[model samples]
Target chain A: MTIKTSNAGVTVIKKLFSRHETFVFLAIVIFGLIITVVNPDFLTLENVFDLLKSYALMGTFAVGMLFVLISGGIDISFTAIATITGYVIAVLLLQNGEQLNIVSVFAIAGGVGVLLGIINALIIYYFNIPSIITTIATLNIYYGLLTVISKGKWLYGFPAWFGQYTQMYVFKFTAANGTSYGLSVITAFWFVLMLIAWFVLRYTVLGRSIYAMGGNSASAKRAGFNLLRLNLFVYGFMGLMAGFGSVIQALLVQTVAPNSLVGKELDVVAAVVLGGASLTGGTGSVLGTFLGVVLIAIMGNGLTLMRVPAFWYKVVIGTVILISVGASAYRRKVSARRRTIIEVE
Target chain B: MERKYSEFLVLFFILLGVIGLMWLLNGSTFMSLNNFRSMAFQLPELGILSMAMMIAMLTSGINLSIIATANLAGIIMALILTQTIPPEATGPGGIGLVILAILAGLLVAAAIGLLNGFLIAHLEISPILATLGTMILVSGLALAITKGYVVSGFPPAMRAIGNSTILGLPVPILIFAAGAVILSVILQRTSLGARIYMLGSNPLACFYSGVNNPRVLMSTYLISGLYSGVAAIVMISRFNSAKADYGESYLLLTVLVSVLGGVSAAGGFGRVSGLILGLIILQIISNGLNLMGVNTFLTVALWGMVLIAVMVLQFLLNRYKEKRRSI
Candidate 1:
């Protein structure tokens, strides 16, 4: 009985190894381990919290981007939208001073995001322009508007409470060595948001609709799914996430620069793809995206800890994206070949 | 007669619209010879990039690496003109340097384009994803070679080629006009052009008809790369400086010109004439924005709005055509 169970466990391990997500999962674990080896401080509880805080906004952007990618589209304009929204929020708070409440600011940011996403959807769905092109154009438009409005100035000097609130510890634990470790409020917020995202993606009709649209738009249309409405919702949701990310970023950094998020869309897309999402649309999971984000964040952190040149980080990222997409293509080809063989037999 | 008149009328109206907008915004300053000269100088490099983009779109592929190719060529040009050949060289040596730089640029770009074509056409990788990889790779190389620094100090003749005008017209504009004419002939009057369109429209049908679809795709990218070399020379000459980051801004602009000019992103449908018109319209909008002192942020938003509008208009037109066919 013990020998049989061990054999069964071996089979399960093999199956996991064969799965696509396993590769990304393993990469994340390995990256984390390497970082710990390079700098023992990297594995410390305080550093972990710092890493989480830094990546919270990036994670938020990835969550929305995952939805868009799953819905068979791309949104390069998200970073631009985030940047402009950050600028607008900064301007409003600076001008209004005592009158602006934190909750109201969040609400306004969400509204701005929905509007931007709606615009993207309208162009893509109504006109049938490729999402990449539409988003690229809008990226320029949004950034241009931000530059004009802000007059290229960096906005700073937020209320002291804003920074404190983002950084405040919500919980603490003592290690066996009598070292105390704490989780910041921002990290707690990120965890809660990600948990909710994971649940919605796994169990909701809208979430499944996103996958359906991406997998095959015509089939989805035949099945009575409203492609236009879904596209709008997906892009709008992406925009809202961008806005939320901006708020988090502003709170964390305590200032907003007009050019703060330039070229960030690439990083977000890379994370989503690395998480096991395909550019061809469909076949991605929020869980995969979460793991992908963790992998990328750890890779960056690990390399920095190892004192690797900054250029190698970009090279590694570019190479990984290339190789992953190549591997996915190869797997599809092999599967197709197998099917052909079975048909012949 | 009516169709001919309509075509002429459309062209006339477009020209008038451009002139009227410029006149309204900057008054006589917009029509000034100096402004015209500057505009003329600007058009060639972008024009070449636009043509490259159009050809790629025709093949149902995209060449995101075009700007990278141009930047690479621009770096080579700077190095050759500034450091390699002496300022006093004449005749064969001077010509040799120009030829060598141009050839190196074209060759490097073509090799990259070929890699993209093979991956996309043969391996079945998505064009966007494949080109994106090359884009990153090439840009990284460009940065590594130049180390984010500018290279300048070209010989007098090279500078003249870039900066000089002929008969009250800039030389770059003249180069653009010449390129447009050649491209028109090749696209409109040649069998190769027909094969390209057929392949783009329906690859399976073309393959059944004994056309080598892959070859058509490969050649299109090669031409795009060659054009990138030409555009790079023009750009380096005009700016009087070559840097790794020079053509980063051109990526979106190139796509915008292709789409707005009536080249269907779906492939197999487009005209050189329409692309030329598209280029003019885009440049005018850009020039107008600059002249009017529009806020930079608002300018981008406005451009985005325009792109969205153009795309919607194209979609409506396509739908209308389909409806007519069904009827």
Candidate 2:
């Protein structure tokens, strides 16, 4: 009887391990434990909260990237989009001596993002340009235009209410060491956004059409899916996420530097790809993306706790991305070779 | 052949038009010999890098790691030169050490290219992802070694490689010219060249025809790596320093130049002559902008706009040609 129950438990564990998200989750747990073993502070509630707070921006961007990748395109320009909107809005607020209104800020930022994203979609579809090529050009155009207009200026000294809004937390607790810990409002926003993305991707026709388009664009078109509309929605959604993420970044860092956000597009791309999104498109998940972000956060935090060189973080992230993507590609090739096709013809 | 000639003709005229515009805008300043000389010097590093990118794109692949590979190789060479030889030394011994350093750097680049090729071809990883991974990893390695410091103080002879004039032309430009000739010969005259075009145009067809796709791809990246190594040599010599972050902006510029040269992004098409025309056009525009004292950021924006504009033009031309053919 014990053996039978143990066998059932083994099957359950095996089934869970079969999932990519579960594998990433397990890696995160193991990595976290190893870090805790090295530095007990790594597992502390304060540090945990700090990790979530720091990685919230990346997580938000990863969600946005997931939408684009699932729709069978890539957009490296989102970083430029984010910086342009965020910087322009902050500069405008500073010039006009206006207070930060949360609703207005988001509306303006997100609206700008949607506008840019629609332009990207229009240029791409109308010209039949490759998504990567279009985005690369736009990445330069947006970033260059921003720098030219702003003279590469940085913005600080946000309104008092913006600072106060950032300090608000969903919950707070005192740790055993008498240190207070709380997840910030921005982190909570990340969670809410992730949940919304998960719901939209899992249950919406828009999401299904995106997957269908990515899986096979020709088939999706034949099935009556509007490729142009899908392109607009996905790119536009990506812009919205970038806008939200930019706000979150500003909230965390309390500064808007135009140049800081452009080059880090790779990190966001790495996170989403690590989450099992194929560059070729048509495959990704919210859970998997969340776990991917967690894995990176854990590795980054753990390395810092262990006093590893900051540069090593890039090496680790790069290796992790290559290994994960290579493994998946190998698995796909093997599956393709092993599949049995019925000889109906 | 006639169509290809017309394409070149159009690019040549565009180059002349750009030069004419620059002359119209800046006149004597743009027409100055000193300005022309400086532009010639500046063009080679970027020009060589564009060729490297074009070669990879020819195989329907890209080496996003090209800049990173160049930096790492240059870093390695810098380390060797700095460690082995004293600063500003110009003896025969120094020349020998420089040669050793150059070869060693090229070897390092080749190894990186081999690794990228392995990941993309053998492991079947997509070129973008594979090269991106290598790019990050290599750049991190470079940063870890240098700790974000610039490596400088090469022997005078090495510096001369960048600054010296020979036969009334800059040595670097001469190098670029020679490299272009060699590359053109390799692409147009060799079996490897044919295989590259075939592979880029259709990999499965190439494979089924008994060509070794993996080997062809490996060679393609290896050649790309060597070109980047050469570009690094030019860059470091020109600046008299090597840094992990050097030429970050050149990545997009190289892409722009290649596409402007009429290299198909989907691959299987491009020419050295067209690329040279593209380089000349860009060089003139850049030189003109500097002479006019336009904002550098605006120049970058202009490059982006030019890239899009050229792409749009290509699309229209292709559509028009197809319509004519159908009629």
Candidate 3:
């Protein structure tokens, strides 16, 4: 009877949360606890809000990245895509100056995203190139074109509403000690998008197809999945978010520069991979991703609080990607072994 | 093999065409001997890095840490020259000390490659992630050592590698050509080259055939490390300085040069002659565009476009071949 209950418990854990994710979740908790112990201010409401806001842009695109990775490809070019879309929107807004409405801003970003997304999708899927190689080239092309045309132009002094639009608080409060805390629209957008991602991934045919394709593409195709159409949508949808993400960033920075974010795609990729999205694709969760973002944001904030050299952060993030991805690969092997054992039994 | 030579021919003509276009656009100034000399000087650093990348890619693997490894290696050599050797040292002993430094720097670069090999071959991590990790760690170590400042003032013998020309050809070019020939021999004329090609073609098959897959994998990255060492020595000598961030831009461009040279990113297919032609084509396009007063950024864009064009061309060629085979 004890063995039966233990077997059931194992089954339960396996079904609800895979063993690898359980490890990741524990790592996040332990990391958070360590940060809190090192600096109790880390748990403060204001710091929490601040951390969320800081990683909000990365959080937005990490979801888009989740979509791509789940479909068995990777994109480092989204940063370039975001820059192009954001830079265009910033220039247009600056040129129009207070006359531009918000609707058109989103429309333009989304439209541009869809177009570029199709191009990205076509190159990766239709041309049968490795996604990383294709995206690397496009990243160069997109950023290069922007740099040439703009000559490293910086767009500044966005209309007041632009910043306010993203920062419009969904909730706000002031403590007796005068520490104000609030949830901004950006964080709310991130949360809502997380829930939306969970819903789409868990409930939609599109999500199922993507997951199926990523797991075993040949079998998925045999199962009647349309590789061309599905990948086009996946990449296209990412571009749409890139467009939206650029506007969000423009809102935050208030001064948009063309090449400032060129090399930071590594951070986004790190965050998504840390969030438990396998680089080989077909596994990840909204909750895993949210925790990953939270941990990254806190790690950055906590390290700054500790006054560690800023230069070392790149090294730290790179280590995190390696360790996490390495653990996943190890776990994958272990799980395969476990399957063989179970079959033998 | 025939298709390989065809790519070489095509790239050779493209190089000539780019030079002609530049001459037409900018007249005789673009065709001057000085301009050609500078272009040759510029090609070796990029050419060497691309050679390292081609070697890594030949195994259907990549070492994204090439630039970082080169920079790190360069920093080591710089440190030896600037810190160990006395400023006034310029005799036979000084040359001996410089040679020691070069060997030490090469050793460090090879050590890093060994680590990459261990990660990929032993730890079984993907090459991209494995090298990306090392690239970060190595560059961080570099930054820490130099404190983000440039290390300069090497012995003249060391500087001469970058500055001195040998028999009408630049030393750097000579070095680049030597590295290429050695690699070509390794790839085309040796049992080791056959093993590497077989490993890249199918690691599983190689393992089944008892090819000592891990050792082959280790040697490929080891070769990349050796190449980085050579490139680093050249870079340090040419610029007469070293920094953590030097040659950061060359990272992607090397990949472009290799892929554009008809080296398959999926591995098991590449040629040294093809890569050389690709390097020439890029140099001409870049030098020509510079002569035309084009923005440096636009030239970057042009390289990206060229990569895409090559991809499309390959796709069409594959389709046509498939159709012919089917008929």
Candidate 4:
């Protein structure tokens, strides 16, 4: 009986390891291990925790991007959305000082994001304009507006309480090498958001419909799905995330450059794509996105450790995008061809 | 056919509107000879870039790498010119080398275009993701080339194209006019242009019709590359320098200009004339705002607002038309 149970356990392990998320998780582990081997300081508790902490806001963006991608569209404008909403919050925080309630900032940022997201949804759904194209235009508009209102000004030296709130670390430790480490409120927020995204995508009717829309829109329509309403919710939710992402980014960085997040749409979108989210949409996961965010943060941290020039990072990102996207596409083609061959046989 | 006429009429009125607004805001100063010359100079580089964007968008594709490609091509040409021309060589020999550099830059740019075409048309990747990758890669390569430094000092002859005026017209504007004419002919008269439109409209149908779709797509981007090569020359001349990041801001602006010109983002439709009008309106708005002491960043926002407004209006019009047809 013991031998039979062990055999069943091995099969269960094999089944679990075959998932895309499993590979991504392993890749993160392998990456960590490899970096730790090369520069042993990399495995230090402080450094590892710091690496995870860095991706807190980006993880937020990826979660949002994953939703948009799963619905068979792209949203490059989210970066712009994040910038504009964050700028509003920052300006309010600076001007209002003692009188401004923190809750109001969150509400305003979220409200602005919802408004912008609805605008995106309305234009995209009403006209069926390509999401990327529409977002491209909106990205410019939003960033342009931010720069105008901010007048190229950067907000710095946030109220210490604001920063300390998110910066509050839940875990703390010190190593023999005298390095200190802790998981912060921001990191907790990232995980909680990821968990919520996973739950929404997994357990909700809206989440499954997002997948159905992406998998096959025409069939989804035939099955009585409302693409327009779904788009509004999906893009609006993305905008809300952007608003939250902005708050997280602003609080963490404590200096809001109106144009800081302008070009980061590519980075956010790339992470989602790297997580196995299809550009063609209808497929992705919350866990996969979290892993993707981790992979990027780790890679960037590792590269910095290796002393690679920061400028070459785009090359690395570009190559990864091409290879990952091409490989997935090629796999799909091969599988389809194989299925056709089987049918003929 | 009526749509074409309506677009032209709308462009004419918008042009008039900008002129009227400029006149009202800045009065006679906006119409000064110097203002016209500066505006003319500013117009060509963007105008040419918009034309380049138009061709790509004609196929419902976006080449986010135009500024990068232009900068790289200009850098290479600058390198060649700087290498071949001795500081003392101010004669016809310097002129000859400049021409050679232009040809080389155009050649390299065309090759880049073909690579973009192959990635999109043959590889079957979404245009956005494919071009996004190439944009980053190519720009990285450009950055690696100069280690992020500017290259400058072209021969007098090369600079003349931008700085000199011919027949009371800026040379850049003349070149732009010539380019516009040539492109209009190529797109309207040539078999290649027709095939591109057909392919853009429906690739599967084109395949059924044996239209050599990939080759058409290749040539489409190749021409866009060649146009970028031309725009690079004008830009380098205007600035008297070339750098990896020059014109970096124009990437999104070109899209704005293209779509605002009524180029269907869905592919299979766009016009050079309409684009020219759109670009002119943007130039006027920019120059006019500069004169009025409005923040330059606000202009960027204005462009965005204009684009969004235009997109929304287009949607409304399409809806109205659909509704009418259903009746």
Which candidate comes out best when scored by lDDT?
2
Model 1, DockQ value?
A: 0.50
- Runs off by more than 4 Å, candidate 1: A1-14, A29-45, A95-104, A173-182, B1-12, B80-95, B165-169, B189-192, B204-212
Top DockQ prediction, candidate number: 2
Isolated chain A: TM-score per model?
0.92, 0.94, 0.93, 0.91
TM, every model: 0.90, 0.95, 0.94, 0.91
lDDT of 3 at A88: 83
Worst 10 residues of 3 chain A by lDDT: A16-25
What stretches of model 4 exceed 4 Å from their correct place? A1-38, A91-108, A342-345, B83-93, B322-327
lDDT (tens digit, per residue) of candidate 3 on A27-83 = 777877887888888888888887787688889888888888888887778888888
User: Which lDDT values do the candidates have, in the order given?
Assistant: 0.80, 0.87, 0.84, 0.82
TM-score sort, best first:
2, 3, 4, 1
Q: In order, what fnat does every candidate score? A: 0.54, 0.58, 0.48, 0.57
Residue B177 of candidate 1: its Cα lDDT? Answer: 82
| Docking level of model 3 | medium
**Which is the better candidate, 2 or 4, if ranked by DockQ?**
2
Looking at model 1, residue B269 earns an lDDT score of: 76
Q: What is the two-chain DockQ of model 4?
A: 0.52
iRMSD of all candidate structures: 1.9, 1.1, 1.7, 1.6
Mind giving the per-residue lDDT tens digits that candidate 4 earns over A68-136?
998988898898899889888887888765666666767888889988988888888877777877787
Off by over 4 Å in 3: A1-18, A97-104, A340-345, B85-93
User: Residue A203 of model 1: what lDDT?
Assistant: 92
lDDT of 2 at A338: 63
